[model samples]
Target: MEGNLAAVLADRADTYGWRDRPLFHSGAATYSHGEVHDAGARAAGVLRSVGVRPGHRVLIALPDSIAFVAALLGTLRLGAVAVLTGPELSGREHAYVLGDADPRAVVCGPGLVPRFTSVPVLTGDDLADEPASLPDPVPVPAGAAAYVQYTSGTTGDPKGAVHRHTDPAAYHEAMALGALGMVPGDVSFSLSKACYPYGLGATVFFPMFCGGASVLWPDAPTVRGAVEQARRHRPTLLFTVPTWYARLVSGPEPRAVREAFASLRAAASAGEPLLPSLGDRIEEVLGCPVLDGLGSTEVGHTFVSNTVTRRRRGALGVVLDPYEIAVRGEGGVGYEGRPGEDRAAAAAANAAGLGAGGQAAARIGERGALYVRGPSVMIEYLGKPGRTADALGPDGWLRTGDLVHVDEDGFVHHHGRILDQVTVSGERVLPLEVERILGQHPGVVEVAVIADADADGAGEEAGGGALAAFVVADEVAPPVPVLAEELIGLARERLPEHKVPRSVTFMAELPRTSTGKVRRSALGRAELSRNGDGSLR
Candidate 1:
């Protein structure tokens, strides 16, 4: 329990009191603690045979199956860094990650063999076929690198966030205590791929830490698939994102599914912000609190979480005690920004608002960025020394590019991406704020706000950009006139007039990443396409 993460996982398996119970469930393929531990040993043997030594990075690009879990555990068990790339990523992207990491070997599925023919490849299926035995757990420091998670960068490249072996265990111990309150005999299911740090924490580590059962699958494209698995397994808990929840609530009558989930004690959401309406709908349907937590790959897991006992519909809940949260500006650290700065800027500006546990939310005055100083923070960005130094300062504080503010009640509100802020008519406009307000409308299911040239405005519109919004509505096309009126009205009331969106376009669905974050640049191009204008296109 005190050594490396692989040791911790093995320790939990032996002493957590549920070692004999089912640890994973893939359709027609169930693996218990002993089976999984043996599979990890076999995977380690294969990796070692391929010249993967301690501290060497090994790329793992396989589907979510028992093999995926085994490979991850095996890599860690060998003290090899697991470069976890998603199976959904393009071959080029996979190559980028593999090349960056320069992995000693790759343990992937048969489908990925062609991409990296030069490197030694060991299929997860092949590893499963090998004899299972208890391999010696690799000796490593608690701070040794565990895995790499590549996040899409603003420059159209992917940046790898590296975590230490101790990170995931910290996540399972802290976040699970507050979010799941899980007990022995609990059954948990996660829709996120095991390769994802969040999924690894919520789906695998949490259950193991709590002495519960975890259900894994190869894939679940449709929410119905998730519901069917939940119904069949009668899992006591489910962890997923808001987009998946939205799809589920919007799908077929969920009465039976809801009733089947009667045994479920807690459900959690992450990856993206959960709309209050979506949370309400799920709560009404399943009669359970849909908890939400905000985390990033750099942080590894949920450090700031909204607990089930204190659920706030729209707010991103309070910060968990395991880490310290703060915001900072070039000038100083504080909470509540100076006057004339945007709402986010003013709220988070120049103030060092400390949480109950002495963790500070440092606010950069008037144009401040969010900063975090916590044990959960990543050690470094893999293979990118310059980027790592830029993000993690000499003081050990991590710069989070999200612009945010803390209210008097100590709730942090996300304003927008630091790069997404636009200046419209000489005033700062945050697309996320406008989009949040627009999303509150009953007719609107989702919305994305962007900046475009103001074709109609005369003087200020000359070569200048204005705000535009794209919406996906449920009932009828959101009355453009009413949408325009309400959006402008809401902006004027809650924000400056210049921050209001001038144009609105209704679409079937907004563009989103696989993880559910809206692609604002894509939405901007879509707006140009809708206008039938070649200029912006």
Candidate 2:
């Protein structure tokens, strides 16, 4: 387990013997597990020849392809750390990562070599030219650094989460094998790219670990691209984000799209919360169960997920085995009682639908900051000890910064990020709650809720700040002004006054990170003109 990640596949090869089963496919190109293993060995030899020693960091900036997989596995086989990054990074962003990581060498396509000005570049062709043979895999401790995965820099500069050599095994066991139940011959495809942790697990490690094949889409996964790939590859498990599913269901010819998903045994959604309505629509249209889960770069992969057997619509599902989840109240005190133990009793008591107060009371001790501890957690944030200390506590629990409530049955429900919460008239408002309500409207395609500072710089009640919503509407929907008014009316009927969005702005789409998460901080700078009649210009 400590030597090399490629060794996992090698071991499988030794046990079952190598076959020509497709291990990686992008369009027409396909590589068997044996081919990938041999390529990884050759790539490792090339990296070694370039002076990349054990423990040295090698930046991998290639797009999702067999080369990317070879580079990653090759680096791991050499006992070197692979610094995975998106190929679309700007020069400035590349500079920041290069400066922070200080890698010994970089493995990327020739097109991206110019971005790594001073760093030693080992192009894909360079690895291809090397001999396809190498010495035995280098041995390293289980705790040795494996890779540095950067966070989606939505709020600020991305921080690299350093993981250990044993993490991939832990992630495979807990998520891929345990939660996803992937088996040999089950083809998988992910809308998320291989650079991100979620996608890395789904499209890279999970398949390799389970002896299954993975379909890689080199281009961005638009609705059409995703459907076409699904139909072409016939993947049994499809991993994508909520936005893609929303688009697929709302796209014209949903019936045709549903037929494309006929090969899918199950579909998984992550990176953002899946609105219950959207989940229902997906199941109704595609005839596939949508398993929603939550994970972060810091955790390597998902530690909490809804299994195919025991699915939950809004809940993030139960925590995976071998991981501990705790809810911390005000002052960071851990809750003593089990979550959701009294959920049934509370739900029975509030069966009359009294109001928000009744529901609030039912959720009273259940809400708090979420914290997790497990073997799969990252070692630290690279070059940021203070930030690392603030996130990973002394006792080893990582403060998730997410406000959540656990029901009596142990289902974890995410409220919103702690930093994203805003106060309106002295009452705290969670954006996810409002977004969930607005997402139910047929006209609303996608929505992001944020607090806008009032003109007077006082609270909303004092005319200082108010809750604003940026909404993306359906294609055939009415004019923005009419839809805005209808949404407001719907919110008024479903939500409390404090929770209702004071203003609604229509947008072509919400700005999102590469992984499909809304950039809340960017919403403040969005050029949304307000009409005199309170309609979006």
User: What's the TM-score of every candidate structure?
Assistant: 0.87, 0.92
Report the Cα RMSD per candidate: 5.3, 4.7
Among all candidates shown, the one with the greatest lDDT: 2
Question: Against the true structure, whose TM-score is highest?
Answer: 2
Tell how far residue 264 is off in model 2, in angstroms: 0.8
- The residue-level lDDT of candidate 1 at 85 comes to 83
> What is the Å distance of residue 211 in model 1 from its true position?
1.3
Question: Compared to the true structure, candidate 1 yields what TM-score?
Answer: 0.87
State the lDDT of candidate 1 residue by residue for 183-220, as single tens digits.
76778877777787768786778876777778887774
Q: For candidate 2, lDDT tens digit of each residue in 257-344? A: 9898888888888888888988888888889889888888899988778887676789988777667676766534333222224556
Model 2 off-target regions past 4 Å? 331-365, 454-463, 531-537
